[model samples]
Target: MIAKFTPVLLFFGIVSCYNVRKHKDAKVPGNANDYLDYVLSLARPIIASSGLDPIFPLPEVTGTFENTILGVHWHGNVALYNGFLFGLSTLTRAGDATLEVVGFRMDFTGDVGLSNVQAGYRCHYDVQGVGDDADINVLIPYVSARFSSSTFLLNTTTTMNSFQILNIGSPQVTFQGFDGLDWVAEAIADIVLDNLGEEILEALESGISDILECIISVTSSDDPNLSIDSCVPVRNVKVIRRN
Candidate 1:
């Protein structure tokens, strides 16, 4: 199970613990809704185009269970560049103390490759698989935490209730690995490939963190509470080109 928690708690912890600039009569540019819209305008694009598809290269893989192994290595890269379309299907309140995010999807086409690998039970594992017309659906639920500025509970992480991944191109991966002892790479790939959902979740978490940080940096604000009226808002979404 992945987590849907956001970095809102980090903002709150920093803001509440320290002295946040209180705009007594801060020329409130707009209401809470407007502020949210403004922030979203900045965040949406960054989230959509954050850390994407370098194929996450792993030169040396290491893990431990009973004994430690070394020199686990790999060659070849997974090409995960994309032609994806992003959208916020729905963002609403769940029950009493949670934020529900649904319809956040990424439609992608990429490749998965692992030409060589050396591990305990597996060696020389290789995959030169292509993934096309694949999509990812995410349902994220966040904890209800208050920040320093507004009553917006949408951006904090006190803890996570859950993070769900509905799909990931439903990629059909084919590969083979052999230790020359008596095992098929397909067997291990099956186990790893079957859990692609976790991979998608991991990517989403990193992307969201980047998006939130981008919003904070561009807005020049510490509190992510939907209360600050950003005069120099990030990028006027009006002129944003999804190219």
Candidate 2:
């Protein structure tokens, strides 16, 4: 009887350990949209107190494309040449708790004499912390564009040019934990761009700046329960143009 009971006890112990491990590994189930909804629900009051937009405006987004061409000819004293231009645009929303970015948008414009143009742009933010005292951070927003064109006034010719918004500085902030604990931490996120044009680049920069300012003004406000200790802004904007 004693030997039989010992084996049964050992089997129960093993089962308990397996259950504990499974619980530890279990994660909260949800997608990006669900996470955003949870954060917004907890941050509404804090955002309003920051003196920013009382009602966070959901961003409006859109995009478009255009192509154009021109030609001329002259003989002996005659020359022939042709050119074409294409453009695209995109608008989006970005932000987090300690930091919130909105009204994010970009436009791409390219000129080509006799060639095809391609481009893409992407923007996203990272948020860290738990509950209301969470902190939101911005990595770096960027844009890039390339153009290829040709001429045939006298002979076939091709030219290629590329540009990028660079020197992206990081932005971050720390908020008091909701439980009023002294625990503090930091987070980071990044904005990526590929094959974009100048007009779109400028639009994207302006939109990102606006969103950052809004986040700073709102998150930095005074709260009786939770308060901000410090603040910093990004410096040194970089732009690169290449062939």
Candidate 3:
């Protein structure tokens, strides 16, 4: 009788081990975009309650010179070559959610010509945990273009362009105890575009700020009492721009 029961006990032990391992690897479902959408959905109420914009428009990407031109020109002499806008797109991964953004293109057809310019930004988030409290790491990789041109006589044009992929190392963000019921916390992407032109650098900084604000607003809730121990805000937020 004991010998016969031994197999059963061994089988049960093996099954328990497997279950434990599976649970250890368990993660929230869907890709980065889906996760972000879900987070935003939860944050809508809090955002509305805080009297802030509940819905924010995703960044737009354009190639037209007119579209690229903005009042605040970070670099370049030509008005048409001043600024560029890029569209956001979702990139999917099997384990973690990786987002690839493309198309920060600009073009100029005036007396001072700016053409064939392109740029891109990529972001990745590793989301852990269920419901409100989740840990996330954001990585942003970017690239841009370099151009050269000379003035010419009547009906003459000179153009030189080269594409260089800037290696901006991964920026890591770790969120601890991010439950919606508790105090909110967030990590923003700090990108070092020192090698790239100022326009691209400014764009990255603006994007990071937007992301940080949204994350903070979404994670935080109002607890006027200040007595609730769990209601305390998350401590120690570190932002780094890698080159």
Winner by TM-score = 1
Tens-digit lDDT track of model 2 for 1-243: 001122212322343334334443211122222332332333333333332211121121122222222442211111101111122111111222111111111111221111122222221211222222122221223223222121111111212123234322232322222232222121111111111233335433443223323322223222333222121222232232211
Per-residue error (Å), model 2, residue 161: 28
lDDT of 1 by residue, 52-171 (tens): 322222122222111122754332222221212222212222222221221211111111111121111112233333112211222222212111122222333222223333323333
Model 1: lDDT equals 0.29
Q: Give the least accurate 10-residue stretch of model 1, judged by summed lDDT.
A: 105-114
Q: How would you encode candidate 3's per-residue C-alpha lDDT over 1-243 as one tens digit per residue? A: 001122222322443335334443222222333433433333333323331221121122121111122564222111011112231121111123321111111111111111222332322222222222232333334332222222121211222222222333343344444433211222211221221245434432343223323332222222232222221223232332222
lDDT of all the models against the reference?
A: 0.29, 0.24, 0.26
Task: List TM-scores for all candidates, in order.
Answer: 0.29, 0.18, 0.21
Rank the candidate models, highest TM-score first.
1, 3, 2
| Per-residue lDDT of 77 in model 2 | 12
Best by lDDT: 1
**Cα lDDT, model 3, residue 5:** 23
